[model samples]
Structures are given as structure tokens and as C-alpha cells.
Target chain A: MKARVTITLKPGVLDPQGKAIEHALDNLGFSGVEAARAGKVIELDLADGTSDADIDAMCRKLLANTVIENYRIERL
Target chain B: MKARVTITLKPGVLDPQGKAIEHALDNLGFSGVEAARAGKVIELDLADGTSDADIDAMCRKLLANTVIENYRIERL
Candidate 1:
């Protein structure tokens, strides 16, 4: 089974990297890009029996910073 | 309009960051995770007139590292 984890900054959290990316786009002449965010994706090939609870545990324990980020787990 | 770009390491490319993440998972005792990948997601809030070609240009010019990474753009 495959699982995909998407981690994004929590609402109201400061994202300097995102701001930097927005600026880079502006320099590249993409001034129409109003706002931008930079996040991370983690793909995992897991054992067949891996449960949703197990994946959730993995996110909370290591994959994401709960205080500043929110992660969604998708099983494929 | 919103656009999403997912940038992932090209196959056979060196991904030290991904490997490091895998190792970290191992240390956290997630032995069932067979293979893992680390990638980037860029979310953009763009002007309504932004065309697919313009978004593609952004990826080619600034958003993605074309040599080691492949990026997919989704408009929403």
C-alpha cells in the first residue's frame, strides 16, 4: 500500500520560506501570483496491514509538527 | 484561481534528503515503511487570468529545479 502525507503550515503560522518563494516568483516576472505557500510531501510504501491509526501515529510522532503544521494522510 | 505544483526527485536521482527522512523514520521504529520519498508542494493563489502556459513557464523558470526534480502543476 502507498500512503501520501502532505504537511502544510497551520493557519496564522509564519512561513518565511513561502514568503521567499513568493518573492522569487515576483522576480521571475510572475507578479500576478498573489500569495504562495511552500509545503512538503512524504510518500510511504507501507506494509499491507498498516492501519489508518498507525499512519496517524506516524504523523503525530515524526512526520509533522503539530503546533505549527497540519498533515493529511492519504492511502492509495 | 489556485494552482498547485508538486516537485519530486527524478527517478534514479540522488535524494539525500529523502534518505535522511527514511532513516529518521527508522529511528522512530517505523520499520514497516519500505521506501519513502520527500518532495515539495507549492500552492499559489493567482490572478484569474493566469493561463496554463504561464504557470508552466513559472515552473520552468523558477518554481522547480528542472535538472533533479520533475514538477506537476494542477490548476484549481
Candidate 2:
């Protein structure tokens, strides 16, 4: 089984990295880019029968920094 | 309008950062982990009525590295 976990900063959190990327894009002549926020994606290949609850636990425990990010898990 | 673009490495590409993170997780005693692939998420705040095709073009032109990554756009 495979799962994809996406971790994104919560709204109102400062994202200096994303801001830097946005500036880079503007310098590259990519216009009309209003704002940018960057996050992370983590893909996991796990044993079959890995429950959703277990995956959620994984996100809360290790995959996501709940202090500043939210995570969503998708099973494939 | 807003769009979220997720960029992930193509399968078979080496992901050293993900490997390092996996090792860190293991060191933290989070077990049952198999493999980890890391990627990026970019959120864009755009003008109202930004078309999906335009968003896709942005991904191709500036947001994603087509050589090693694939992107998906979601509107919110």
C-alpha cells in the first residue's frame, strides 16, 4: 500500500522560504504572482492493511509539525 | 482565487533528502516505515477567475521542474 502525506503551514504563519521563492519567480519575469506559500509532500509505501488511523498517527507523530502545519493523507 | 500546486519527483529519481528524513524518523523510534519520497507544495493567490489552463501553464513555466517532477493543481 502507498500513502501520500502533504504538510502545509497553517494560515497566518510566516513563510520566509516561500517569500524568497516568490521573489525569485518575479525576478525570472513570472508576473502576476500575488503570493506564495511553500509546503512539503511525503510519500510512503507501507505494508498492506495499514489503517487510516495509523497513518493519521504517523502524520501527527512524525510527518507533520502540528505547531505550524496541517497534514492530509491520501491512500493509493 | 487560489490554487495549490504540488510538485513531486518522478518515480525512480533518487531523493537524498527524503532518505535523510527517513533516517531521522527511525532514530526517533518511529518504526514500520518503509520508504519516503519528499516533494514540494506551492500555494498561489491569483486574480479572480484564473483559469485552470493558466495555472497549468504557470506550473510548467515556473513552478515545476519538468525534468524530474510532476505537478498537480487544485483550486480553492
Each model's lDDT:
0.90, 0.85
Best by lDDT: 1
> lDDT of candidate 1 vs native?
0.90
Top TM-score hit: 1
> In candidate 1, which residue pairs clash?
none
lDDT of 1 by residue, A3-49 (tens): 99999999889999989989998998887999999999988989899
Q: Candidate 2: lDDT over CA atoms?
A: 0.85
- Model 2 chain A scores worst on lDDT over the 10 consecutive residues at A24-33
iRMS per model in Å: 0.9, 1.9
Q: Write the per-residue lDDT of candidate 1 for residues B41-64, one digit (tens) a residue.
A: 998999999999999999989878
Cα miss at B53, model 2 (Å)?
Answer: 3.7
